[model samples]
Target: MNRPAPVELCHKNMRFLITHNPTDSTLNSFIEVLKRYGVTTVVRVCDSTYDKAPLEKDGITVVDWPFDDGAPPPNKLVDDWLTLLKKKFQEDPGCCVAVHCVAGLGRAPVLVALALIESGMKYEDAIQLIRQKRRGAINSKQLTYLEKYRSKQRLRFKDPHTHKNKCCIM
Candidate 1:
């Protein structure tokens, strides 16, 4: 059965708040929020499976934290993004990382939670903080990714059980 789509979740700081399949019009909403908050850069997750995203000319320093639609970050992209996030944490400790995807449910939150983990936060703590910071912390799929990213399976193939037809299957 088809699941409900993901929804946009906004927050005051860029503390990992991203959109769920934002439209061209919705992108304007994002831009407006970023402008109001004086945000300069964003760490967007390009879909490794479909390769869809906003134009490259958006001028945002796009970081390809690759992840498939239903899967987690690929091995190569996972290590690459971890290194990037490590550097960013050292340089921009307090800055926010906006992880956007077709939907906030899948790749976006997974990357955000991973960023939290890289920022020296515990896995469970990271998930909870994300939940508090961004009301829509993650969906079942993203949580599955987080679970794997927390365990030994991070950066590997996704868990079959976690990749279920959940409440939101973005």
Candidate 2:
């Protein structure tokens, strides 16, 4: 099967593997590729659902956070996704998060860009970085949202014992 290779984007401790949806014929190969990147989680932002058993069998967590095609994600969805990522990275610093929409060009890149921006990267820089790695990423509407995006305080993982912020993307 001919599938586009996953694009790897990294900023400090955060790493994201961006790719298109895998068909049944290519799923095995996809898993192998994800393993090579030490991916511990796969986040799907597309409308369809795939069998999660195979990935879970390999100890990779799969999360489905579907949104419309060519549209930016809702504010709550973005916040929740950042929280999920923050917790995952805090638990495993070396783990990579694989994110995909149908083509890995629109929704997936937008989410990754938002994460980068929240992690102290400028909006334009984030867009440039993703476009460099995954060509044709981020549609115009999505770009508009990103252009106006103001990074909120960094997502923090709190230390349970001390009630202090233990980990932050920034």
Q: List the residue pairs that clash in candidate 2.
A: none
Q: After superposition, how far is residue 38 of candidate 2 from its true place, in Å?
A: 0.7
RMSD of 1: 13.6
| Whole-model Cα lDDT of every candidate shown, in order | 0.55, 0.86
Stretches of candidate 1 off by over 4 Å are 1-14, 46-59, 133-145, 148-170
Q: Write the per-residue lDDT of candidate 2 for residues 1-170, one digit (tens) a residue.
A: 45457999988778899999887677898899999999988998997546778999999888889999999899888988999888887887647999999889999999999988988889999999999988889999999999998888464434455945558677
- Candidate with maximal lDDT: 2
Model 2 TM-score (2 dp):
0.87
For model 2, the stretches where C-alpha displacement exceeds 4 angstroms are: 1-3, 155-170
Residue 24: error of model 1 in Å? 2.6
Candidate 2 lDDT trough over 10 residues, lowest sum: 155-164
